[model samples]
Target: MKLQSVAIFVLFLSLFVSVFSDTARTGDWTPIKNLNDPFVQEIAQILLKEHEKQSDEKLSLVAVVRGESQDGAGTNYRLVLEAKDESAATNIYEAIFWDKSFTHFKNLVSFKKTYLILLFYNII
Candidate 1:
């Protein structure tokens, strides 16, 4: 019947919009540079250590420094990290924020915001 066909079409349209709309609004977050600073490296090592503690598999990590701002001759940095896990991904995120090595970064709040997106999947 036409009514059934219309209902199915509506459902498919809604699903398509829901899946693709987020990607359209927010561009993909890709790594710009590998973290090379000793401090940043320390944070990464801590995260990897935590991952190893939780799971036996070797963990892979990618660090991306996205933005920098200068105010009153002071520099602030925003970094995002992508971590892989076969079991729990959220755990890796929590460990990074809680770890002390990242404390010196003046913009932890903004950094957390950028990194949090890793928890969500973006279809593009």
Candidate 2:
């Protein structure tokens, strides 16, 4: 009985470790081709185009949903920005916020260049 209990405890410990270990892994963001929704696809394309313009910088576009109220009126977007240098990331954030597409959410999420780089560094 003691041997069986030890095996069960070891199994549970391994499961716990596996589940928490990958929290540090960074997820890859790939562009979705031929999305059924034209609106979402258009946004993605715009973000991709902006990213392409910054070819000298290491950047990627990621789609995410933002929310605040329980009614869920926050905006969804494909954001393109640098993940390394704080200055580059800030430039990208300013450019995106200045862009007409993201004018609405500018007040919602104060896009900080340093924040994104730190976030990516932490994840990786």
Candidate 3:
């Protein structure tokens, strides 16, 4: 009877550990369900403004194509955006932004013209 109890306890402990580990893991990016959510649009706008400031390009955000976000010290957004300047055709860009709203801190991590844009240009 004692041996059976020990085995049962061990099984419960292992189960608990597996569940805890899954919950504790971080940095897994998950797709935003509502692409049209105002908050997601706001994040995309922020990325465009930051990119414009850094590059001195006057690009207006046409739309957010898609995005995923990861939770960490701040929320990290990976977005595919369509934007265009005054004289240029709409182009797709991929950008990453990290935001900590509680602290009012935000950073533009990276931005680059995506292959889709390059392929579009080549075909035209």
RMSD of each: 14.6, 12.1, 4.8
Q: How many residue pairs clash in each candidate?
A: 0, 0, 0
Residue-by-residue lDDT tens digits, candidate 1, 1-124: 9999999999999999988775423233333244576766655555465556556655556553332222232333334445555654522232322322244432233212234454443411
lDDT by residue (55-98, candidate 2, tens digit) is 54444443322211111233433343333332444233312212
For residue 31, model 2's alpha carbon misses the true position, in angstroms, by: 16
Q: Candidates' lDDT values, in order?
A: 0.45, 0.41, 0.85
Q: What is the C-alpha lDDT profile of model 3 across 14-107, one tens digit per residue?
A: 9899877745346888877787999999988889889989999878888787788999898999988888987978888889999999999999
TM-score, every prediction: 0.31, 0.24, 0.76
Q: How many clashes show up in model 2? A: 0
Looking at model 3, the pairs that clash are none
Using TM-score as the yardstick, the better of models 2 and 3 is: 3
Best by lDDT: 3
Per TM-score, what order, best first? 3, 1, 2
Model 3 misplaced regions, further than 4 Å: 1-25, 116-124
TM for candidate 3 is: 0.76
